[model samples]
Target: MNADTPMIDTTAMQRIGGQLGTNPAGIFQDGNGRRYYVKTLESPAHARNELIAAKLYQLAGAPTLTYINTKAPEQIATEWVELDKKCIAHLSESERKQAQQWFAVHAWTANWDAAGFNGDNQGVVNGKVLTLDVGGALAFRAQGDPKGKAFGIRVDELDVLRSDDGNPHAIKLFADMNADDIKQAIMVVVQIPDEKMRRVIIDNGGSHALAEKMIARKADMAGR
Candidate 1:
């Protein structure tokens, strides 16, 4: 569903999975039997941040869980799609082929945690690669884009690839992808207008101030 959809109440969502993280977050099944990983964000702004990131992922056509608009401002939910236990580095070469879009999406959002030595946020499902968690993305990188170089990738004294900013080791997964596809993914976000972004925030229980922040962040990414 789009961001303009109404927020759903958690009252009817039955707990299905075990409690996770330090918080009381859980996997819940809605009345329709759709499961979602629901968690209370650190703050309302963070909730909006996650929402924006989810939308960006959706816009890029990244294979990811669907972000839900919970009625609680500090809470968020993502529709769960079962994936194999393999982590980022363990993905087979074939599964990695379509990973470029999400990688570019991560860079534009400054999701350093998705890369680096920590890569559990992603895995494979039926041979298709997808990222699972991106709660910490969307910090926004304004300096370098269009060329999309904010991190370096090197091998045998040769620079092979560069991202907006991720660990050289972790982000190299994107190196073998079609550059045009990655650029197109980044452009999907860059093309969103301010009014639409504001509507997205307001429709999702985010404050006007939060919408303003997202607008500024979007402008920064676009201006670059």
Candidate 2:
């Protein structure tokens, strides 16, 4: 874990709102009085996927909510944001373009939850578009089941990308990303230490074949 990542202390956390997905989450103050939204996960797969997604986004220089792992409740704490809007209507043309480009990170990670109800999973913080809730990434299905049905849009789906009524901008944005952009994003994943990466996969009950498949998929995407 990075030294700067915020680990949750249950005694210091307090529930502030409704649950997020199957996890019960809420706002909490850290030892330093900093506030964060913490979501608890019962599944080891969710935890592992969350951590890996966060690290990949950070390494790729993309905007995502910062997350820290916790023990007791098996939770992850993300930086809190207030007063976020869904549609890109509020963003300037330049910001919209940047947001479109930044969405390449999602394509790289295969996050199907990128666009929530009215863009609930994405928001503008400090005048920048930041992607949130990447727990739905990497794996083939919603539960991160390798043999499960594919959940999100595959990287190769171009036509259906713009068909989303909820947040067509997301699909359109991702569709605009070229192979090099995706390759650049996946390059960061390739840079992670093999031991560390393998440990995360093994600890999460992921098989060696699954890991190899993930790597191979990224490599194939880079080549296309």
Candidate 3:
């Protein structure tokens, strides 16, 4: 866990809803009375992916939810926000820049579930856009994994090399991202300590090979 990652007491949590999608997630109130969206995965690898991605986004200066690692394995609590849809035209220049930087960083992490792209996994807080879910990142399939055949699944190299499409807002935001902006985003990944990264990989059943591949992908994005 990152030194800054919050630790939540699961014993005080109160579930607020049914399962979300295939993952068992619920809206809950913590001991302090703060509400959060908690998601629990069956795979340790997936939980680790979500936590690391959230931390990377924070380092990259992107708008993201506060991610906390609960006592239970495969579970995490994210700061809650009201879901809303506001067109790009409604965003101010600063918000637009933040959104673009977020897209660049998301691309660096090979995250395909970003909101306003292919999924409704985003929410607005104080008129700024924040990513609500980042669990679908850094995925590596072993031989014979069925997800490998899924259409539109983004791999590390492909995400680094691909251009934004389908979402007009994302396309416009990315258009404003210069090479330097991309390099800064990639540098965030480079700044993460190796020991912390290794723990995340090993504890989550992820291979060192995948971690190295992701680092290389960040390098490729920086060069692009």
Instruction: Give the C-alpha lDDT of model 3.
Output: 0.60
Query: lDDT by residue for model 3 over 1-224, one digit each (tens)?
Result: 45566777656787666655446778888667787778777666567667776665665566777776687777867776665644555566776666655665667665655544433455567777877666755552211122343322233423432354654444555556676776665565556665665565555556677566556655565465
Give the whole-model CA lDDT for all candidates, comma-separated: 0.60, 0.60, 0.60
Residue-by-residue lDDT tens digits, candidate 2, 139-188: 63334455254533235422234455555655645555566655554465
Give the residue spans of candidate 3 off by over 4 A: 1-12, 17-22, 82-90, 116-119, 140-169, 172-206
Model 1 spans > 4 angstroms off:
3-6, 19-24, 140-169, 175-224
Clashing pairs in 2: none
- What TM-score should be assigned to candidate 2? 0.71
Looking at candidate 1, the ten consecutive residues that score lowest on lDDT are: 151-160
Model 1 residue 25 lDDT score: 79
Question: What lDDT would candidate 1 get against the real structure?
Answer: 0.60
Q: Backbone collision count in every prediction?
A: 2, 0, 0
